[model samples]
Target: MIANTVRQFARVQQRRTLSTSVPSGVRYGKSFGATWLGDKGAWPVIGIIGGALVFCGSFISNKIMFHPDVRITPSKRNADIRDWR
Candidate 1:
């Protein structure tokens, strides 16, 4: 009786393993942004906007880091050093 039950259990497990149903026509590769914004004629506009944001960010960061006045005033204790130059 135990052997019959084990055989039935094995049959049920085999059926469960072999009966997996994956839906057809499903896309796994496309991005959510591509789907939302659409796959047609949207890339150039996105590229231009992304490029502008990068350019503006770099320009602002450079302006803050390398401006001449910023280089002259390193700290409060070094204020007198400016007079030597």
Candidate 2:
């Protein structure tokens, strides 16, 4: 029984060592942002342009939709609410 257990353990250890070995011709190296983004330097410019567009869009939309002078209807009922301002 002891000999059978030793043989089984030796076979398992051998299989594990063989499976963990790196395959031939496989190269590992450091990764850079350029690998995914095409150009690492352009990220900052892209971020700035995107941020500016978002800010300007929100600002314009707010000014058009929520300005105090702009009312839902240009009638006396709407004008009566101006006292709340």
Candidate 3:
């Protein structure tokens, strides 16, 4: 998409100040890309917290915003029956 094209152009326009060459004796590290399933450290806790947040959000919001909204209603003292509708 356009995002990739913009990233490509931005990278091409960037200047390097230091050599990025790796040491000759160093072997290539892990080849796998990151995923939620593969994550054993933070992902599990993050997912539980995320789910809990979604589940509890409405309740928390309603409690925090709790207020009684008053509305004027037609009554015999101030309003005629014919004008009630």
Worst 10 residues of 2 by lDDT: 27-36
In the range 1-85, model 1's lDDT, one tens digit per residue, is 9999999999999998777756564568888786647756878888899999999999988987766555534464356454333
Please give, for residues 1-85, the per-residue lDDT of candidate 2 as tens digits. Answer: 9999999999999999999999864545625544436667878888999899999999989986878766655563446558534
**Candidate 1 weakest ten by summed lDDT:** 76-85
Q: What's the lDDT for residue 59 in model 3?
A: 72
- Tens digits of per-residue lDDT, candidate 3, 12-43, equal 66633224655564545634433444568867
What local lDDT score does residue 18 receive in model 2, on the 0 to 100 scale? 91
- List residue ranges in candidate 3 displaced over 4 A: 1-34, 64-66, 69-85
TM-score result, candidate 3? 0.27
Kindly provide the TM-score of model 2 when superposed on the true structure, using C-alpha atoms.
Answer: 0.40
**Model 2 off-target regions past 4 Å?**
1-36, 70-85
Give the poorly placed runs of model 1, Cα more than 4 Å off. 1-32, 71-85
Rank by TM-score (best first)? 1, 2, 3
| TM-score of each model, paired residue for residue | 0.42, 0.40, 0.27
**Highest TM-score among the candidates is held by which one?**
1
Compared with the true structure, all predictions reach lDDT values of 0.73, 0.76, 0.59
Best-performing candidate as measured by lDDT: 2
